[model samples]
Target: MIPLLASLLLVTTRPAVSQVILVEKAYEYVQKKEFGKAREAIDLAAANESTALDARTWYLRGYIYKELYKANPATGGELRAAALEYLGKSAQLDTSLAYRKDGQAVTRYLVVTFYNEASGDLNRQAFDKALTGFRNYLQARSGEPPDNAYATALYYAGYTSLLMGNQSGARQYYEQALRLNYRNSSLYSDLTSIYEAAGQDSLAAGTIRAGRQQFPGDTVLRITEINLLLSQKNYRRVEAIVEEYLALYPANVEVMLVAGTVYERISQGDSLSRESYFNKRKEIYRRVLSTYPDNFSANYNLGITLYNRAVDLIKAQQYDLDIVLLYEILEKVSGLFREAKPYVEKAYRLSPGNLNAMRALEGIYYNLNEKEKSRQIRATINEMK
Candidate 1:
């Protein structure tokens, strides 16, 4: 009877084996900074039926995995993801809020990781993964007030979505960022382009106008507004706006090109004022060439303009006029051709393969009585055929 009682006491005094013991072991290993061992113990605890539902088990597992990720970032994406999962589980299971605060703090850290990874993914052209990572960052930051960082993330999300060909999604993110006062000028420009591509011209115009209001000195926005007015055939408004832009940006080459084209377009319609506008067009092209001597458009346009005027003069010449008068007219036509020669020759040198320049050069040589050069150009044209 004594042996039986002793045996029974021994058995009763010993602790029963439970899955919670694994969780306790994990915590002990964590205290010693032995995260590898802690991870093994906590994973077992998390897999067991009894401790799997225990909040302490999940919290310890989350902490262990998070530590592993911190130790080895190069191989830690899966580890960090695991940590987030378990931490979320712990927060969900802990009705008493025992791990809620710590879980949230850890989540904020993980959110930074998500954002960093998203930026890397974006640089690598991993559009789908980048989009997901950005959303994860934003979701983690939900309920936060709109700030510069938040707005910047929104812009990135929109940019990523645009790269993914998700136009509607991009529009939503951009609009949200706009409401938060995102200060990037590209945000407005990109959104405007999207609206215009969707055939929402009014919205495009409104967005660009808003962008110009916000960034009054933005050259791109100014040019975009000019183009929009041109599209609407609002020539009067376009001229007024272009003159204002020129006064502000006197040496802006792009604006000068636009101004020259505008003058040419106006001359085509206003017959009574055609010569005046044509002179303005030529003057603008000359100004561009003075600054950018090698500008192809300026060289080609000026040369062609002079060439066409000479041809028109030749066609309108009066053969019935007196010989002296005819000689004067011939001199004027020859003078115009002489003025056109060097420009067309320079244009031909700039783009040797351009058939228009080649043909123009041939005509210029023929008109200048350079029979050999004209024949050589004609032979080359025939050879190309």
Candidate 2:
């Protein structure tokens, strides 16, 4: 009875456990590499009203979680996230800057996880989650962002926003990337397209021009600029740009074809300049054929141009024209048809199954008064039907 009374008396006199003691115990567990127990101790300290507001307690909690995460990263996503949160809180609450450096140092270890997780979310087409991940990555930079990594994240954020159909959000992110001097050429073109879609033509043009200045050798931007100018009926500017491109890349058959096609379209409406443009188009096609003798497009295009010119002459014959003038025009038309025959025939040979090339040859033969050739081509065309 005396032992029981004495035990009760000792219990009554015992001091309460301190919250700081739990923190110290957590630190001791961490020193022994018993991260799980350290986490439990720190969590208890954090939940106590007395220690929950302490900056050092939060920092210790963050540090302990970080060790747990490092031990087993594959299953430590929650641990990693919690560590970041606690560390950030420590930074905010630590007015004396006592834990700021350590907190930031720990934060740097977790930064790449945010970006990696965000990239995975992007690839999974989970756009909303991906955006949130990127935002977290930016925040996790801990106030000292590496320029290249920072710009890359911003650019992709814009790209993901675009995929989500959030053009306004995309533009904001893209503009930020641009201001940071992000080196990707697509950034300029994308911004220009956005501006154009919003009916901001001046801004679109300015963006494209700025992109061209920054990436002068970029073929995509050059082509994009040419297309924009062409849409504005700015033919002279289009010509100047094309000629400049050709001067730099004379062997670039693709741009040469584009130039010739553009000239052909321009001649369709500008009668006063029709003959000159056609001649220019013919010269470009000739250059292409010179380098690529068996090229189907150049052969077909040159033949068609001559054939159409002959047809145009015939269409212009007036009812009351002088007989000598009429004979001269007929002679000239026959000469043009003869000139078109070999090219059309070669084009037909290059693409033996092309109906258009067969038809063009048929027309050329009929125009040149070659009845036997015309009959043979006509029979082949009928057989295909």
Candidate 3:
């Protein structure tokens, strides 16, 4: 009877002693940064029937494995796979543990860390690894509602699909991300590009419009929407929009330039006489020139306007009048040409084989009736060939 009692006592006390030892060794390994050793201790503690079934033991085991996987230099897929396995076990063993103040915080931190690491893989252009990591992060947070990080994960996943050239997948994921939160401006840009690439210009324009409504003051979206309208020849609407923006910020040069171009387009489409239309064009160009003297389009258009006026005078056989206007143009616009020369010459110097600058110089000389200068420019253009 005495021997039997002794055997039962030893069996009972053995587990208690093993549990204490296991806990101590695990903590010691963790303090020493020996994550592998710490994981081993936790694994041992989790194997014995008496200690293995405890929630804290399983939680510690999961935490140790998570740290180990994070510290490992393995690929994102490998790390995520291992982390998912451990976190899955912990979640299953104790769902309530996640809501425990400290437990919830720790679990959230782990989830976020895993997500970011996976995102880094995606950023490195490792699409497959990133996909796996994102999947693992979602699985680990199985019962949670969509949070900011969750939304961001969906966005990145869509972008990864784009990088892989999977258009259908990209659309699905981007839509999912947007459904969660349409306030993401950068995601709108991506969606716009995707639709534009797919030849869905109307859809792209609508997306930009929606983005503008959501982010009223976003200059980039406003500009893109305006450009799309201009491309579609929706000039009246663009004119109205530009007028609104000009009212808000009157001295904006870019807005003024676009407004001028829109006016020129409208004038071209009018059923007006050349004399009437030419006068209108001259007024618009003058307005742009007055406001932005150094603007290239303004200077170039002013030159064209002078040439046109001279042509009109010549058509009436008013030679003296035309010559006097031409001389006045040369004197008044000399500084514009001089300023433009450096830009034209830079292009020429950069690509001596290019004909763009040579052609421009030739046109300028021809209009001025400088035959020697025109001949030199023509030779340069020929040599570029």
lDDT of 2: 0.87
Which rank order by lDDT, best down to worst? Answer: 2, 1, 3
TM-score for model 3? Answer: 0.63
Pairs of residues at least 3 apart in sequence or in different chains that clash in candidate 1: none
lDDT of each: 0.85, 0.87, 0.68
Better of 1 and 3 by TM-score: 1
lDDT (Cα, tens digit) per residue for candidate 1, span 1-385: 5699899877764443456787889999999999999988888888877788888788888888989999998679899889988988998899999888888888778778888888999999998888888898888788667678777888999999999898899999999999999998888888988888788999999999899999999888878777777776888788998898889888998898899778777776777887797788788889989989998878888888788778877988886888998888889888888888888888888988778988988998999999899999899889888
Candidate 2 clashing pairs? Answer: none
- In model 2, the Cα lDDT at residue 200 comes to 90
Q: Please state the error at residue 86 of candidate 1 in Å.
A: 1.8
Off by over 4 Å in 3: 4-24, 31-34, 46-54, 69-81, 95-103, 118-142, 156-170, 189-193, 196-206, 251-343, 346-385
Give the distance in Å from residue 244's predicted Cα in candidate 3 to where it truly belongs: 2.6
**TM-scores for all candidates?**
0.71, 0.64, 0.63
On TM-score, the candidate that comes out on top is 1
